[model samples]
Target chain A: MEQARISARQLLMLAILFEHGSAMVIPLGIDAKQDVWLAILCGMVLGGGLFFIYYRLFTYYPSLPLTAYSQQIVGPFFGKIIALVYILYFLYIAARVLRDFGELLLTFAYPETPLFVLNAVMMLTVMYAAYKGIEVLARTGELFFFSLYFTAFSGIALVVAAGLIDIHRLQPVLEEGWKRVFRIVFTQTLYVPFGETVVFTMLLPYIQKHEKAKMVGWLAILLSGLNLAFIMAINIAVLGADTVARSTFPLLNTIREIRVANFLERLDVLFMIALVVGGFFKISLFFYAGVIGAADLFRMPQHQRLVYPLGISVLLLSIAIASNFSEHIKEGLNIVTLYMHIPLQVGIPLLLLLFAIIRHRSSFLFRKQEKK
Target chain B: MAREGIKEIFDAIERNPQFRTTASVVIARKQTAEQLLSVLTPIDKIPANQMIKTLEMTETVWGENLNVHAGEIIEDFSLAGKEIVMSSFRLDRNLKKGQQQENVQFVRPPARLRASELAMFKNGKLVRWISGEEARGVLWILNKIKQTAITVDWEGKEESVSYKVMRAKTEIAAKMKKGKPVLTIHVETEGDVGEVLVPIDFTNPANITNLETKLRKEIKKEIQKAIQQAQREKSDIFGLGEVVHRSYPEKWKKMKQTWNEQYFPNISVHVTVDTFIRRTGLRSNPYFP
Candidate 1:
């Protein structure tokens, strides 16, 4: 059913943008204090290992998506149940990311506009992208990749030119010790921007170069990881660790400090652009993954038909998820990362891989004995 | 209230067809808002509403006084964990031609730029004004000192031997001693000789070293004075509290309540200054020397 194929480069772009999406704005691993950058690096390393598991699982099937292959690994009934759970997980995460963008826009730009309107508008765009098929989304990622990098680099340049960064704030590094960094890495950072790539498993079968998938995934992780680390470091250096932790959107505040001349002040526009672009790609990818997964499980011909229903559901779910932004963030960091992300992203995938290996070994040994 | 006051000022200015143009304005808290408005008033129309010509130019101009924006104040306030924030602003008077000609042989401009003074805020309220070397000392500690001239005594008198700070870096460390925080501030500054009022010889390297020691002592004195004032005001303006919190988080939990009141006031501080004289200006020594 998945006929469209995306180039390896497109996959790389999509992955980078996905990882940088809402994670960039929200202070991921802020509990690490000034060593938040360090924590991100450590998380990226661990995330690399997690991706290896997903890659191995993908190799066993080769042509089938995670939804299709699970049935082959286990019985069809349980595999169908697993696929349904993953579909729900994908849609729920998509809603959560949508809410992230909506809340950011509400607080940063429009305090008066109802969050429903903001999220609905964002969801509409994501739905359109989802309906367009994965090829279109990948092409869009390739197009936006350069502009995103341009915005990031220019932001770094302007901040440096303004002499706002005082590296002294990042000093006394590892002051409290390694425990907090490691704790935050495992609990928050590793799962968030890194392990969220589990959604890509649904899309990996669409890649044209299956042989290069592992390399592309790892490179994308490294690039986005370093980008996030550097950006967070700059935020702490410019705004100070205390401010970064306290502020809702530290990057917006960091960009606001770019006053080269009197005329060149208030450059939060760069932040807004980067955020919207990143949010668009990220939300679209997750939304697409859910729609496609649902279509596959229900034995539907066109996944495009499910887009509108799922899109509306995601929009409403985003509003209903939490009473307020703080609650949303709290639930996300504490509950979702622990309960949802770990089990679906890591636990179930590893379980499937183990089952696939054991089943293959038993069948091979039985065939050999029969032949003898 | 501050926002309303600013809006009202701009509204009044906008309504006045007499003064149609105003570029930038930096209003310091040296005078009451009424007094400031009063000075701007008593407007005499020069020739049909170009009121720009009439009033005493109480408006602050660039190069005369540094303009501190609201964003910067908020950033610093948050960075220091709401303890204390400092900004520099000063009032400048545009001198009329007669006063400028009377001051010196050479024709001077029709304006005078006053030295920038540091304004300290505690809990978002303006607490005190710090001027002179003490203000510069705060700048040094904050690593905001870009170009400042420092005067050292030459030949047993406070004669002009000013070292212009080219660049500076301040490193603050908070160490736990006997379960209490002891602070150490290390300042490394490099500069050129700006002015030497007395005859000073740069021919011998010993003289340079001697000058360096004097400069170091002078910087140390300024930093101490600033710290003393901050402690007297019960404000940890140097972000020393943050340093302690960063280094020893568990200990800071108990110390947070009385940080400014008890710990900061009685906190033992050690200041170290390292001064390097890179160049002596146009000549090796002063032409007079």
Candidate 2:
């Protein structure tokens, strides 16, 4: 085993993606109308619980990766199978993330480019980071995190100064009852980047200090959640909720409207770059986790060999998965939201924790008997 | 599974041979000029030409009867201008000149002459004649016949007063209509005052009364009060200036559409103060000066 040290701030970058990705989808899914900010608030509250669950899992197995700890907690055979299923689940999610990035790029920038080209380029970048190991990924995240933060806040400030923002746009908040808000919250938390933080379990073992891991994890979640919520609020305030819902990329659309002195139009290009970089970190982390989990379950000599094949597979699968953007969005809302996310994000983790606790209690009893 | 579903849709679209990438054209034309004419030939159909009609034109040109193939395309046609040449039959010598001059000045009609001057012939010699203000009222009638020979025709009572006429150190007076002396006048003088009485014609008395009534109604205090109230409310919905402004845009552009901005300003308004002496207090004799 090699020493893999990731700082609290690097972990915070991963957490930002988790929160922002889901937060980004809220404006995409629900017809926010006049209450987009409210929709975002509801999403954060629901996403907070999901984040806490990941935090709980990180606390329980402080030093063990989820794949190894899962086997120890359950019987090896069943645990390995469970771990393999999780790996496959993660691979599917990683592929979908890659597809989202490719689709956004193709739609916004180069309409003539093939989907595979976009997918392949992104997959290669993620693969390079994944092959470098978690330390490099974490350090790279740490380096880029400040730039990402600056870009996000500066983008918001520029939009505001452009006179494009209307505070009145956020009015008539919570016009739809709590029920509608809850539905939006549930969809966002369940399927999107929020619940996807469960994949962070794979990275928990790499934290430099084990005790501060839980604190850092929770802090990352909180900060990222607030940042995402603010971004959502700004997007809605600037574009208005109705327009946000209609738009494919809410942030891009809002940024494109930023025209300071008539010369600073089309800021979406810069926005797209930020999105791709952030999305790269997000996708690469999941891809690495998927490969490592699969290798552990198969008792392979090295996980690096699985990376290229898995990368190509994801690229191909993403192209084959959705015919168009609308279908992709529909699958995200319907199948991914209802079936895949609930069990993986909420159910499986809780089950594994229960199993871990019972095993611990039984081992204590067995040791006491042996002493007698 | 999802990929297969999407593939099926694309396959179905490709397999449909009749599915066109663009819009199609339709045409309607006669198979032959007359069904009885069995000598007509049918041409092969092209995609561009779904239908075609044929006709015959007989004309005598250059001393020979020529039977020409002629027909309308009945839809759209693309022709090459280089393949055909056309010439006009009119001769250049028949064209008129000076009709298309680039510039020309317009002449105006003559102005009307003033009254009180008369042309006279004494012993068939030209001389000055007397015509005073008594005849001034009928000057327009007299001037119209001055250009042509005419005899005077009178059918009304007329009266006149004695007056002196002065023109270039000449004074002339004559006994006119009421057996009073009339003065010929070109220039004005204090002693040259003349008076004439002509029979009054009162045509359309009903219309005159109607007009008077309408004027009186418009001049009422209640109408003025309503207008004042509307002005205070800043409701120029009546569009008084809008009407004039619309009729004369160039003149009104300097004023600007400032009714909402400045409200109404500099508009001079006058209210007529009519005091009826005969109808004071509804009794003519009770009026006190």
Candidate 3:
């Protein structure tokens, strides 16, 4: 039995690394076109509102992870099933992000390398991070946060210097009216990177200051929001929206365009380093959540023992999840966004929040009426 | 299950570790790049790097001495907009495109190899190559003129006057004329007399005005030649389509599909050149022996 704790800043870093984890690698909502920056802005503002709702739910059941409190909120049988689903979601998402990382490596870096090798390597590292516990993961995240920004900003600067960034490429802002921009904001961009932060609910209980977790959450959201907007803008400015939409790895393309004074060319390696570091944090946090949530639900003694089995399961699932990269991308955009992401990320948590308020505010009255 | 689809391979090559992401691309005349590089001299240096440098110099400083880089080529071909016109060039015994000076005495043997051509792309494929003044015309229309020369001949005079451009600015406006975009390009050039072989009054404002009109006309002719060549090749290397896209994004989406194929050739172009001669070199006329 262990109680792992992290500072509010570390929590923010974890949230940012997780939410921006996948978005940083792939093109974030390519359908948003030149207006993706707007989509990111809208996603953050709205996702921030939703995060407030999640925080409200967490505060009502202080210091208890979702697995522990779902039982108190709902009955035993329903709670176990809900907890199981949350555990599965944690494992599934960890696997999904793992797959995205693997595919990125395969598609961008190593074409000849086996996909399983890439997935397995990431899974093993995540397992190690999870075994070491949340503190190590948080520290690694902090280290990576600076590196990620440094790489991204330097890439942008080089791209600008190369005169590859044409502000004209980001033209015709909101050309389809506010309605079109808002649509993708909710449907596509909202789910993946923004709403995806819902998984962090499991980590919130470990915050040193539980009350300030909301503030940390907002800070994390705003930070990632601006980052997403800035990157998408650069992607459009350099690669243009059409190229970005077609390319599997738009950031890689954008970074590759960075030829500063000639010799600084092909800095996509820097991007690869940052994404790998970010993905490691994201997967580790998700892995930690899944192992802990499962142990808590089953009343298992040691969470560490669950790490290996769970990580191997994830590696296998990640390999079997989709046939290839395109299918994986399609599943993410289509199945994950509409089905798993919406209901779990936004819908279920929302329902839980509503249920918690009713149960707390009116429970005594209901019990009194029953006794009479 | 693994399928190495075309898309996947393309991405791998794009993000490959070995290839330089910022390497300059060369688009040749339906020929291997080696044949083009074969003639590019300075045998000790890499041909690709030299070609890239040559193309870069073509953007701002070079006139007949210029070359268009790979990045500029992509800008003209990118499908985000339709009215895109990029640089066009070629190579031979004579230095074509933006060749500036004629009489440079060689101190030593120059590089035997040279790559000087701007290959215009339409929809990501090479469409045509426009050389000499036409290629320079592309730069003028794009406002990429830093320093160039124009020789305006007086109708009755034997020797001509040459103006050296110090500053050049072009403003291209894309507006709707009927149902399509009508591009109006305005070019302002500031220069000074570099060579005056014919006798002319340096103090007289009338003569300066006279030379300025002749300079404007010459520059206009070059631009017109470029636009006409683009229309002939149906290449919008000028990025005129981008102007339309920025101004009217909603309409552009529908138009972007056919922009390079059908619309680019049909779009109307209006070009105006403004030349202001800042000063005359030292003496008004070439130093008479």
Candidate 4:
């Protein structure tokens, strides 16, 4: 039972930044090769459809968060278990994105810095933001969104002015054909950054205006999706599809190649800024969702006490997530995307929606039969 | 410019916006970095940025010289593991353009821009320089040819026909033939008759067709010469290796190790040039009968 309310605009900004997050820094959908942009567009379509399921569930229990509403849908015992699993899922993803940004900064800028140090600093900052409550986090997102796009657009302008883009690099479209593109769309792109918006279900009840929530959510998804696709296309066009696929961070490499008049080269800083801002918001939102959900399920009067413990766990979990950066990436792409993301983001929400529907229909039918 | 760590130079340029940057770097090999920088320092009396503008306006328009920035080198050689081929120039303070002043008390050495040479680099080391028709031939195969005036003999030694290339596109395809990679370079270009010293009537459609046939042969010869020079040097500057890598990733992984030394030097390449004389410029049939 949180009293703070955020406007629809803040919700939109948070979701957009959440979707952008580390997804922008790391190469997403690169398995599709030159048609990676096409795969992102396909993921957006699937993600948009998935949003409606969460939206309908929100409609069923508008006054309560997902953790509380699951109890009403099923019985108390099962709903508490589902809520606990979701809380753990949010914390897990928060840790994963935390590790992603930490690894990027370590590789690119801070080679000597320990991974734990980077993750700890980021986790501490996120803890502060989450402790401030959802309203402050949303407002912070509203402020950073403008600066994020400013760097993004200016970075793109420099790349174009440098004359690095080669349209032919994207040529022979679907060179390997549609099968690979769709496979990428379903496995990695769809569940990842896009379907990961399922974390927002815990925060939906905090919006000031419920009527505008659906539109804002969809708009944010569409805009962030297009932004990702456009950036990937530019990366492939500038660096070529093969180099892009091979790159650990394609966007970072793409920005590095932007040298307009020789004065504007070495612009990986802009990429770092964008990634940090994006990663901050992403980790904060998931951290907030997990904190509030845990509080709701545990019947705590205030969620503030739980933030520090959970934040420390996230920091530790990020470091303990994998042995090395490659293993971390591999586990995220191959193992986690299949095992954790699909089931929690897509499967459970969908089944919860189905059960909610059945409960509604059966109750209505019983009432009708009693009247007869 | 090539002596300094390309990253360090770029970082310095980025830190100070007032110093600004030019389109091309003066690459030197024989001289020390201090000598090259000092030689370029005084030449700033005329300002090289303005000179770059002049080159872009008069030279790049006519497609004689091109501007290759440091970023292209970083991307190609550092990121893509590809060779670098760009327009090369020698500082000739003696070579001046337009009219010369008469009996001047103090005459500053004029830095004229003339690009007849191409510098090729392999793994950050200067390999060799190719000039004359061979350089233009490389540009042709790379499809970097813009509006270049190609002069062809007409009627006799006194008369000539110069075709201006307005647009050009190069398509390179690698196909595995009998388990060996073969390359097909197709150059498609169209241009107008820029200057004609001959007395032929260009208004007639048949005459334009006849001129295109002759121009095609000249272009083919230039491209073949360039390709021959590249193969001889064992340099894959045209990024044919990249094309092969894109077409066949698994195969390239094996070929990449010995690409420049083994595969590129021995591979067979087929060149095709398609040319068209679209317009006859401002005047048709010339001023003569």
For this target, which candidate reaches the highest lDDT against the unseen true structure? 4
Tell me how many clashing residue pairs each candidate has.
0, 1, 22, 0
The candidates, ranked best first by lDDT, are: 4, 1, 3, 2
Per-candidate local distance difference test: 0.77, 0.52, 0.74, 0.79
| Candidate 4 lDDT, A175-236, residue by residue in tens | 88999989999998998788988987988999998988789879988999999999999999
Q: Once superposed on the true structure, which residue ranges of model 1 sit more than 4 Å away at CA? A: A367-372, B1-289
TM-score list, all predictions: 0.57, 0.55, 0.56, 0.57
Q: Candidate 2: which stretches are off by over 4 Å?
A: A1-3, A21-29, A368-372, B1-289
**Candidates, DockQ:** 0.01, 0.00, 0.01, 0.01
Could you give candidate 1's per-residue lDDT for residues B1-289 as a string of tens digits?
2322332234445556775433323333453333333221112212112112211121111111233444444444555433444333222353343133333333432332333455665655557777767776776776666556778888887747988666677899989889888989999976667788887765445677788899999989989998898888888877888889899888888988788788888999999999977545433445453
Query: Which whole-number lDDT from 0 to 100 does residue A307 have in model 2?
Result: 86
The RMSD of every model to the true structure, in order and in angstroms, is: 19.0, 37.3, 21.8, 19.4
Q: After superposition, how far is residue B90 of candidate 2 from its true place, in Å?
A: 30
lDDT of 3 by residue, A217-306 (tens): 889889999988888898898877777765667788788777878688878788888789778877887888899999899888888889
For model 3, the superposed segments whose C-alpha errors exceed 4 Å read: A363-372, B1-289
lDDT score, candidate 4, position B223: 83
Error of 3 at A13 (Å): 1.5
